[model samples]
Target chain A: MRELIAIEYAKLKKFHALKIIFAVYMLTVPGWMYFMNFFFQMEPGMKALFTSDNPFDFPHIWSYITYSASFFNVLLAVIIVVVTTNDFQYKTMRQNIIDGMSKQKVILSKFILVFFLSTIATLYTGLVGLVIGLIESTSYDWYQNIHLIVLYFIQTLGYFSFAFLFAIIVKRPAIAIVSFILYFPVETIIGKIMNADAYQVFPLKVFADLTPIPFFKSIVVSMKDQGGKTPWILDTNIQIILSLIYVLLFFLLSYYLLKKKDL
Target chain B: MQQEIVLEVKNLVKNFKKVQAVKSINLNLHKGEVLGLLGPNGSGKTTTLAMLLGILHPTSGSFSWFNNGTKDENRKRIGSLLETPNFYPYLNAYDNLKVVGIIKNVANLQERIDSVLELVDLKERGKRPFRTYSLGMKQRLAVASALLSDPEVLVLDEPTNGLDPQGIAEMRQLIIDIAKEGKTIILASHILAEVQVICSHIVILREGEMVYNGSMNSLLNQEQAFRLSATNMEQLEQALHAISGISITERTETDLLVTCSEKIDGSSINKRLVEQGIYLSELHAYQKNLETIFLEKLTQ
Candidate 1:
């Protein structure tokens, strides 16, 4: 098992796409924080700008980071796609099999690497949120923040797991990236204009709803302020359950595709 | 033969989609023998080797190594190099071999790596990255990887491809030396001369079918006729025609080529010619080489 992990680590380290995505994430996270604080003045306690009592509130941080870096997550997903597709493209998996690695081990290695990268990205974003929250407010209970951190990590895994499945099925990086990018707007537009309740079950909706943000509370606030009808049918518990189901289904599907593949 | 069988393939068959790459290949290798898998491109040489190594799943057949079943335990006793040498380009030769050692579960891996590198004559270049090495060096490193576990049987597919003439000769000698140490080797190659020089047994595949499988010398001796040259012109032909055992093929102004039905040597032919009052300046006998036999089998 230790040797297997070492081999997977070596493979991930050698992948160029993973390296570039990591560099991009490192640069973008700090840069985005600086821009929001200095130029846009979106920092808390600014009278002219919108401010919350605790911008580090789970929902607030989720919305800020997810909205700010959602495009970057898409880019990271593209990197994952490229990394996953290369084993098939270059026939390196065949060589790995010849070298005595089992099919299950090969697929598990890639999956573990994907989870590792997602965990790293999640922790980075959470750290950035913690730093910005500290600058905005000096006093807060760090112990209570564990739940938010756990939720954020789980959400990140959800997105990356879906991307992993996409990559495994398509076996082509460009197609997977395009499909994931187009997924968001397609679901949003269909949800609002067509009044489709089925969008609630879509993976993107589940990810957004489970992202530690009280989206329903925000919607209710907006509705009360504007004198409009309340939106949404199911509660948060159902959404979380659905997301977990999606995660389970996607993982099994990915495993099935990998096991049946000729490579 | 019971104690000698090191590797056995019984009616092996492999198909890719609608095309059958290997068709009912039956082969048996003895200990301390080099079996040459001779065929042209796309004749399923590599495919057969892959199946024997268990890297490929045969459509219908069974093969065993040293009477052990086709499992990881059996695979541990066999080492193979199918297709090209594939390793991490960024890693040095030593590191690459170390990785292979770990995969093959070798104990005292560092010492084994050192020994393999020295065996392949790459001890000095072991620290250099594999990408920086020449094609011949890379192939040698691959050989070193295959030899790391001191496997009982080594299956190499075109091990000398891209190698220079000197490298080819060195590799041939190395294989022969390894076989002398009681290791069975199955070499797949298209180089007829190398096969003839190194292989004790030959298996010829043509269009996914085994056309010939036997001892190399016996295969060569299977040819019915031999070419004979003589200095006497028509007298040699007239003398040869009179004898029912000899058949004259070509009669030139200065030479007469004849074929004998039985296995006859130069001295017997010369004695017969002299007894018939047909004096000859020179008498040369011809035997079939591997190239001719391969071509004949392939064409048939």
Candidate 2:
């Protein structure tokens, strides 16, 4: 396992596109967070629209960090697609098997890659969160805020595992990335027909609800106050458990696809 | 010498959609023998190798490696280069081989990589990314990876597919050297001459069917035929009747093809024809090589 991870890391380092995508995610996240934070404080219209205490305050700091970094997961997912598709495109996966690694080891190597990437993303988000929170928040509760780090890791894992599945099933990077990017709107359209509680069970929605925007939670609470039924998405633990299941399902399906593949 | 069976494939078949890519091919690879698989395009050579390496699932039947051990354990003892060199294009040959070494769990990683690099004659260019390599260099690197583990058996598919004349000669010699090291080798090629020079045993596949499988000597050492012509047709006819174990397989207006058993000597037949007063002409021996036999089998 350690050897496989080292090999994967070496390959990833040499892959220019993946490195570029990762650099984009790393450089863009903090700048994007800073820009959003600056706008909410400086722009009167933005301030009126947001209508909240300093969004970067102690309790809100976790949500701010995770929410701001959440959309960047799409780019990271694209990186995953590129990395996985490189092996397929070059037929290196088949070579790996020929070189004596079993099919399970091939899939396990990619899973380890996903775990590594997700861990890095989680640590980066944690670092960004700490800096921003110390700067903006008057009080700090490390235990409360650090839970968001775990959720962030799971969310990244969910996204990357889905990308891995897409790359395996699709086998073409461009098509896989386009399809993954399009899945959100398609799922949203499907979500509307299902009851709100049932829609929360969807994979991406489960991940999204993990670090629900701080303002969105306030709106949901007020809606409940106005006699709105509390959607199942309000239960973070259910979403986490369901997300875990989906993560496993995606990985298992990816494994099955690779194990049964001809190449 | 008793040769141990290293690979046993029983009724192996592979079908892709409606096309039967590999018909039931049954073969056993013995230890330290170089086996060549000969066929034209779409003859299921690659498919057969893929199935053995577990890259493709066989549609029917089964194959076992190294005394029928589990695949994981068996694969560790085998090194293969199937169809193409599958490596990261961006990585140098050394790094690509390091990945192979890691996968195969080779000890003294850098030392083995250096030795294999030297073995392939790519020590100088091992630092260049694989994409920069010419086709011959790419091929040599693939061979290098297959040899990385010092595996018991080597499965190579068209290892010389894209080499120049000199490159092909070098590759042939390399294969010969590897075979000398007592490693079982399964080589697939359309180049009949390459197989003839490098392989001790041969399997011929045509349209996904095993038309021929046996020793190379058996494939090439069949009864030979000679084309005979004479100035006196009448005397030639009479003289031909005097030779035993020589049958006329084909005849033209000016020539007759006389087939003889392997036990018959050309000089004896010549002496008999001379004794019968029918020798004032030409005699040409046509020994069958693998190309003729392969073409004949394909047509059949």
CA-based DockQ, model 2: 0.75
Could you give the CAPRI-style class of model 2? medium
Q: TM-scores of all models? A: 0.83, 0.93
A257 Cα displacement, candidate 2 (Å): 1.7
Q: Which digits, one per residue and each the tens of the lDDT, describe model 1 over residues B1-300?
A: 345778788999989998989999998878878889989999999888777665677888898888775764566566778888887666688777766676677889889999989988899987887779898998998888888889888888998987899988888888878877877888898888888888899999998999999999899887445455555566666777777667665556666566676666667777887898877786666676899779978987
User: What is the C-alpha lDDT profile of model 1 across A1-263, one tens digit per residue?
Assistant: 77767776655555555677789888897678567657544444552334443444543554566556554666666766777766666555665666566666666776676677778878888777777766664555544444555555666667877887888888766787788777779888887776567767778777766653334466567778998876664575786677677877888888787766555
Q: Candidate 1: what lDDT? A: 0.74
Q: What is the lDDT of residue B9 in candidate 1?
A: 88
Candidate 2, residues B129-221, lDDT tens digits: the string is 999998889989998998898899999999987889888888888888989999899999888888888899999998899999999998887
